[model samples]
Target: MPSTVTSHHRDIETDRHARTRITVTTTADATAVTVTGDLDLATSPRLRDRLDDELKLRPRALIIDLDAVGFCSSGGLSVLLEAVTNAHARGIPCAIIATQRAIIRPVKLLQLDRVLPLHSDRAEAETWLALVARLR
Candidate 1:
């Protein structure tokens, strides 16, 4: 089951399990994606699509808000890595919001924290994006 919602030029997609939802919102300087729910094998594809869609827009910065994520598997991590790689290849700055230890611990264990800067909240992530845009 796939469901999509479009609002104010933003595209939102929810997976069949209804356990995962990805909301993509674009601003003048950045694209912000909010993920809510478990990000595992069953829902990683949805996230990949959403991220790819946002990247296609070629925004100056990409901010992923993962504060609501309860779990993330290797498959989900792969999707994230792909997104970061794609963004970097395009010279787009990417930021992640992972205030929860459940989300932060796995990323840190994999040393992904070094490559993907993690923020404590959406505001901080947005600020980072803004600063990156200003510098570039």
Candidate 2:
């Protein structure tokens, strides 16, 4: 049986500026990280840390929900790329979900979607994951 993992939520403040909310939910199927707020220079570190922690769990898949992310700078984009690389190295499938144009525009403009494996919704993300499954 897979051990249960609790959901983690936190507010990160940097330079008394941007705020980012990161929520990590782990289960037998997959570990999901939902990001809300600006993912810029100051806030990117917090997201990176959260992503690293979730990756450590080595879940069946890493799903990043970026729908609520209003802004994503290079720092934020880099974190997503790094997460994908790390997940691949660990043999864990990864998917990024974004429904809003705010986040998608930058990702597409940078051509990050090619390497990031982005989806408009969780359903679509899962549909794209070839071998991942919910064994429970």
In candidate 2 the C-alpha lDDT for residue 72 amounts to 87
Predicted candidate 1 versus true structure: per-residue lDDT over 5-123, tens digit per residue? 33234548677565677887766666789899988888888888889988988876888888999988889888888999999899999998888776789888989887877899877
The residue ranges of model 2 lying beyond 4 angstroms of the native Cα positions read 1-16, 130-136
TM-score for all models, in order of appearance: 0.86, 0.82
> Candidate 1, which segments miss by more than 4 Å at Cα?
1-11, 16-18
Roughly what TM-score does model 1 have, to 2 decimal places? 0.86
Task: Give the lDDT of residue 19 in candidate 1.
Answer: 68
Query: For candidate 2, what is the total of clashing residue pairs?
Result: 0
Instruction: Pull out the clashing pairs in model 2.
Output: none
Mind giving the per-residue lDDT tens digits that candidate 2 earns over 1-136?
A: 2335654444433334666677776666567788888888887888888888878877888889999888888888889999999998998889899977877898889787789888888778766664454432
lDDT of each: 0.81, 0.79
**What TM-score number comes out for model 2?**
0.82
